[model samples]
Target: MGIEQKAGNMGVVTLKLEEVINWSRTNAMWPMLFGLACCAIEMMSAQASNFDMSRFGMELMRPSPRQSDLMIVAGRVSRKMGPVLRWLYDQMPEPKWVIAMGDCASCGGVFNNYAIVQGVDEVVPVDVYVAGCPPRPEALIHGIVTLYEKVKEEKMKDWA
Candidate 1:
C-alpha cells in the first residue's frame, strides 16, 4: 500500500477526489447516539443483533459528541433540548453530518405544541431526514445509503 500503481497497464481505474473521500467517509461513518424519544428504540434496533449495522461501519454508537462526526438525531427535539443539541453539534469536529431520524426530529411529527421545536433542523443542519414515526432499521439503512450518495458527490472545493 506504499503507492498506487497500474498493473502492467491492464486497466487503470480513475476515481474523483470527491468519490474517494465520500467512499471513505460513508464506509466509516461513526454515528453518535443522540436519540431523544421513541425513535431511540428503532435506532437501537438498527444496531442490534438482527440488523447488525456494523457492516455499514456504525457499530460504535458513541455517547460523546467530541469523538463523532455523524449524529443521528433519532427522536423529537423539544424546546428544552434544542440548546443541548446545538451545544453538542458545536462540540463535534469539522466535516460533521446530521441525520434527522423520524418525523418528530424532522418536523416535530404530531407534536404541535410550544414545547416541541418543530424540527431538529432548527437546532442543527440536517444532512438527511428519515421519515416515519420511527423508521425501521431498513429505512434507516436506506437513509444512510442516501447520505452516502450525497457524500460521494460533495465537492472538495467547498472546503477550500
Candidate 2:
C-alpha cells in the first residue's frame, strides 16, 4: 500500500493538493483591466514587449472584474470614486488580491487634499504597495514576484 508499489515504472509524480493549487494560482494570475492616473503608464510598460508580463503567465489584463483574480490600483483614488472602486472590488470573485501601485495609489502622493482619498486602502484592502511617484516597471515586477510568494505560502485553512 505504498506509492512505489502502486506505480512500479509508470512515472507517477505525487504532491500535496494544496501545493498544486497554490502553484496554479501563482502562475496564472489575471489582473483586472483598470487604472486611474499616471502610474497606469508604468503598469502598461510592464505589459509591453520589453518587460513582457506574459513570461509570468499573465498574457493580458481582463476587462471584466468577474474574470480577474488580481487588481493593480495604479494611481490616485478620488473621494468620489471610492464607492466605485469598492463596487468593482466587491464584484470580483472571492480569493482576489489587490496591489496599490505607485505613491499616488498607496498614499495619495502629492495630491493630499479632500478630493483625494489619501490612499486606495481606504476604498479597498491592498495586499502590496509599490512605492514611487510612479513606480518603474521593474519595481512593479518585483512587487508582483513578492505577491506571488505571498500567494504560494497560503494554507487551505486561510482560504476557508
- lDDT tens readout by residue for model 2, 16-134: 88899999998999999898889899889999989998888788799999999999998888988889999999999988999999998888889988899898998899999999889
Query: For residues 1-160, could you state the per-residue lDDT of candidate 1 as single tens digits?
Result: 3244543444666988777887888898888977788989998999999988898888888899988979999888888889999999999988999999999899989998999999889889999999988899889989988998888788899877
Question: Candidate 2: where is the Cα deviation over 4 Å?
Answer: 1-10
Residue 52 of model 2, lDDT score: 92
Cα lDDT listed for each candidate: 0.88, 0.91
Off by over 4 Å in 1: 1-14
Q: Quote the positional error of residue 34 for candidate 1 in Å.
A: 1.9
Task: Tally clashing residue pairs in candidate 1.
Answer: 0
